[model samples]
Target: MFTDLALGALGHPRDLPTALELAARHGFGGVDPDVGHLRGLRSRTQVQELADDLTSRGLRWGIGGLPVSLTAAPAVFAEQLAALPQVAEILAAAGVGAVGTWVKPMDDALTYRRNWRLHVGRLALVAGVLDDAGIRLGLEYVGPKTFWSTERFPFVHTLAELRELIADAGAGNVGVILDTYHWYTAGETPADLRALTASDIISVDLNDARDDRERDEQQDQDRRLPGTTGVIDLSGFVDVLVELGYDGPVKAEPFLSTLAERPVDDVLAEVSDLLDRALAPAQELSRS
Candidate 1:
């Protein structure tokens, strides 16, 4: 139930120290490491050291992820799933709470049954690792691009469908990771969030969208500030989360590539200001 907002380290500096400094500077509670960015540090020692550095900085490791396409061949998906244990192990050693993933391009109903079975099996393998080490799993559903093979899939386009998937997973250690951009693009209503059960959401990534742009048009627009573009009804979103009783970090995740190119200090300050103001109450209320 803590008021935590973990900044996404996806496009930030890859070095552990730099990443930590960014999180610390931005007042983030944790770091969500993107696996691709951790390229050179593949060994157990290197990972452990990274974890240690994060701990020394008073930050927690939240999740580790890879930008994998789910629509690939079955063999390919399986190959990716097979690697989860190693990733899970590394995250555990670093004292991270969970491992998160987006659906690959190959995951359809056929692959859902296949991918689910495989994912479940792989999850079982890592569940012990997570439990013994005390970590969780966040399965975030994005657009069709994430998993196109299925007639319909859990992409957070609709909250109803997303909840069903969480129930289906049947792992106490697993849940959905909601992203505001996906919800907007899916055209789901704010009522969707109101009907949501808190148990289903494991993590939340927040960002604003532009009104005129379709989800596909902006290659990296989801990274924009909350009120800059779209008529996303920021007030409603915050109200729904309040009603749902969500008490997790509200991570700022923008894909605006240009922001990364600017000065880190300026970007951090601007992003922080945007988020703070976006959720500020329009009118003041007298205390009871």
Candidate 2:
């Protein structure tokens, strides 16, 4: 697995170039650039220059975010969909392969039944755009039950449900962004992961939760760095990925507010150290 950094979760955010530099300095293999940065580039030349700069630093460009909302109204959604070709062109030029977005839980304005159907159709549209550009879509499921209480309905919160949704969408190029925090929160075991092939997972996010918090009580930004807390079985998680032959980017996404307050170098150092420890078993497996 490639060691990657998720810029958005890095306490204080860094621009793509700076993030790439820090990633290389700290021994990371790749990084997920902020989509907003790519969207800001004025031309294809600039995008290529950025890509070249990453190459020069010996850093891989991992997945980026999709700028469109998958659950927007038909007309609004079409406008967003129309903009993807330009985005895809830029991503293709920059050599980025995948774009990801979260699948939020249903709310009062959108019932579960309606939202589910909307996602199937909308994701099909997204899949077409990305597939035509030779990019894959990494769809992430929000696993915390606190999200479920407000909706009081069955939402897509598990890997099985996400797989079924993707199948329903009939989007051949789409897969899941398997986040360890969400997997642990959802109460999925290593046995659960064994059922999935490597292709079923598009990418991965690694982080730990506070040991004091109940599974449902953990907030989105209340996460710890990998292996810092014993709340999640991170070693076993990586072991399963190794066993399943998942050769993909595994990013650190600790959302702790304290990390944001620290110096960028210090934050990156802590993340780098913990991630190496978390992935040590997987690395050994790879060598064997």
Candidate 3:
């Protein structure tokens, strides 16, 4: 697996070129660019220039979210769906092969049953657009119980449920974006990883949870750096992915407020060091 940097995890704004340079300087193999920032580019040549810059720095283009909101009202959703084809073309031109977004937890306005069905239909449409442009779509499920308490019905909070949703969506180009924090919060085991093929996973996020909090109580923004806590089996998770022959990008996404408060350089250095330790076991296993 390759190391990637999610610009969002930095909790700060950065342009595409600066983000890429940071990724290269901090030993990341790739970076997930903020596609929204590139919406102003009106020419294919501009996209190619960004791609060429990434190539020059030996960095791969990673995943980003589509500009459309699939969870809105029917009319709004349709409008977003209609615009996705153009977004897909732009992403394809930039050499970004995949995009992803989170499956938000249950909210007051939507019931679980309705939300689930809505997501299946919406994602199917998204998958069609990405497939036509030769791009992949990664779907992430929120695992925290705090949000689940708001809805009376069962929600998609586990990897198994997330997989079911993908199957229901019936899109060949769609897959999961596995996050260590969510995996642990949802009580997913290493066996879950073993059951998955490389094709089932589009990308990965590496982070740890606060040891003091219960598994179900850990908040998203309170995450710790990988290998800094024992709340998640990150090494085992990596080993399983390695054994499964998954070669996608594995990015650090610690959402700690302290990390956000720190200098960007310091945060990058710490994340790079922690991730190296977390992946060491998997690297050794691969060599053997």
Candidate 4:
């Protein structure tokens, strides 16, 4: 997998043009596409220009946030769903192969069974549109118990449960967005990664847990960049990806609110360097 840059998750939400420049300068192999930046381009020519810019910078298009909200009321969902085809087409033409969104681990109202059905049906429809345009949709599961336990009803928060959810959807284009924070919190092992084929995943997010926190006490937002704390087996995660022959974007998604306090340049360089270090073992394995 290629090291990708996710600006917003790192608290550096800049325009796509600026993001691209930063990504190139910092040695990111890929950069997350801004859906808004893409939608702003009215014509195919504009989209091609954007795609060509990525090519010129030697950057791959990374997964984008799903524009359609899965948890919206039926009417609101239908409204958002209506506009997806246009967006999907633009993304497809721009050569973005994947887009993703997270599933809420808990709900105050809907029980697990109800939520499952809602997600399956909605995802099938969404996947249908995306698949038509040759793009895939990835769904990330919220894995921290600290966050999920807050609501009255709990939903899928484990890799196994999310895999079941994906299987239930039965969409060829629907797959997992594996975040290391969730994988670690869910108590999954390298075996879980080994069990999955490359096609079973759409993307990967890397993060390290807090050193002071126990596994169950881990908060969703409390995270460090991969390999910084050695609290997460980020190297093993990368090693497994390499062994699986997975070829996709693997990005650091440390949702630390304090990231905004640090200099953006430092954050970008640090993330890039960390990913390089994390991937070093895997790189050596591949070369050998």
Candidate 5:
């Protein structure tokens, strides 16, 4: 099991140096950055510089999980698409192979087709850019709280459906981001995680769920730390990962703001420690 610290875990730190320092100190193998962190980075030269910074600190470069939405205006989609290629350039130079976005289009009766068409076209275009830059695009399907909420229709939701959707978009570079939190909330079977190929799985966000409670209200309350949250079978989850041969970073992405109240270093250390414990059995199996 590999550990990677998400940028937002540092309260969305503006600069890369602070973020990178925290990541190195916390024993993260890599850092998942946002686009803003790139600053005026446009060309491969600037991207390479950032990569060098991570490499010098003995950290690997992971994907930039930017929160760009395709459900927005066509102009907004175009702007995001244009900006994404720069991210690919950054990833290519940084030796990062994966990039993802929480971009899900909403179902609007008025402009549904228009929005869908624009989204597909823009994603295909962006996928081509990522492919040219040697990066993979992880097209994440967000929960209902997001634009395209799959919460209401749990039975209808499946990775196969998403795969078909991406196929409809004709974007070969785009794949899925399997988040355990959303999977639980969406009422998906744990077996669904196995259905995806290791290659199609571009990113993984590991989080456990609480028992039946006011899920929406517990927005900050639900994301329990591994092992601390007794509701999920952590070992079973890891077994699935190993069964699927997913050697990528199984990231701990807890979104509770309460963690922010503590010292950033302490919070990071705790996250690392907790995840290490939860994933230990899996590591032993891998070594064997």
Candidate 6:
């Protein structure tokens, strides 16, 4: 795994060119593309220019957020799905292999069974479009009782359930966006990760939960930078990914508001340090 820069995910958003330059300047290996920013590139030539920028800096494009929202109305979903080809073409040309989105774990309308079928059908369509462009689709599971437990339908919020959705999606390009926060909150173990091949995952989000709360009591929005708190078993999770030979970008997605209020350069440098420090010990020990 490599440290990836995702300023927007950390509550500090930057334009694509600025993000790439800052990532390289701060020593990041990859920078996750902002799809909205990418949408402005009108042609393959523009994308090539962007890709060349990345190559020049010895950097790579990390996973982009799937532009389609899972809970969109049928018409809205169709509209977004329709625009995907152009998006995919640009991304594939720029050497971005995969895009990711989260499975909405709760639904006030459709029950789990109904929601599952909707997902299978729609994502099969999304994956088909992405497949043609040689891009893969990664689905993330949202685990946290606070998010899914209520007087509503709780859907796939666990890794196993996420896989079930992928299996049902029945597309070769479908994969997982396994986040350390959800894995720990779902009570998944190293053995769970051991079961996956590197190809089954498109990316990983490294983060830590609040140390004062029980796993189930944790709020999804309240998170800490990886290695800030040992409340989650990051070592075990990282070790398993290493043993499995996972070579994807692993970024921190701590939802702290303080980061948003800080200077972009300072925040990026600090987050870069946090993510690098989180992975350094394991890598050093392995080399030793």
lDDT of each: 0.59, 0.85, 0.83, 0.91, 0.67, 0.88
Runs of candidate 6 with Cα error greater than 4 angstroms are 285-288
In terms of lDDT, which candidate is stronger, 1 or 4? 4
How large is the C-alpha RMSD of every model relative to the true structure? 5.0, 1.4, 1.6, 1.1, 3.5, 1.6
Write candidate 3's Cα lDDT for 229-260 as tens digits: 87788878988887888878888887777766
Relative to the unseen true structure, what is the C-alpha lDDT of residue 52 in candidate 1, on a scale of 0 to 100?
78
Number of backbone-clashing residue pairs for each candidate, in the order shown: 13, 0, 0, 0, 1, 0
Off by over 4 Å in 5: 10-14, 42-46, 66-68, 108-118, 144-158, 212-222
Per-residue lDDT tens digits of candidate 2, residues 107-200?
A: 6667778879889989998899999999999998888777756664557888878888999999889999998888988889898888889998
Best by TM-score: 4
Question: How many backbone overlaps does candidate 3 show?
Answer: 0
Give model 5's TM-score versus the native structure. 0.83
State the weakest 10-residue window (summed lDDT) of model 5. 147-156
Candidate 4 per-residue lDDT, tens place, 1-288, comes to 789999999997999989999999999999999998999998999999989999999999989989999889999999999999999999989989889999999999999999999999998989998889999998999889999999999999988898899889889888889999999999988988888998898999999999999999999998988888888888788878888888889899989898889999999988999888887866777679
Per-candidate TM vs. native? 0.72, 0.95, 0.95, 0.97, 0.83, 0.95
Please give the TM-score that candidate 2 achieves against the real structure. 0.95
| Model 4 TM-score, all chains together | 0.97
Stronger candidate by lDDT (2 vs 4): 4
Better of 4 and 5 by lDDT: 4
lDDT of 6 by residue, 1-288 (tens): 778999887787779999898999998989998778777888778888999999999998789989998789999999999999988987888889889999889899999999999999999999999999999999999998898886389999999888888998899999999899999888889899988999899999999999899988999889988888899888888887877778789899989878888888888888889878777755676688
Q: Candidate 2: which pairs clash?
A: none
120 Cα displacement, candidate 6 (Å)? 0.5
Give stretches of model 1 more than 4 Å off. 1-11, 34-52, 66-83, 104-133, 143-157, 214-223, 278-288
Local accuracy of candidate 5 as per-residue lDDT tens digits, 1-288: 477788574344437777788888888877776556564676677777787888898887666765356556768867877777666666566687877876443453435455456667767777788799888788766443432453332221346556766887786678887776666555566587777777777777777665655444334334766666666567676677777777676677776667767777887898788778877877788789
Model 5, global lDDT: 0.67
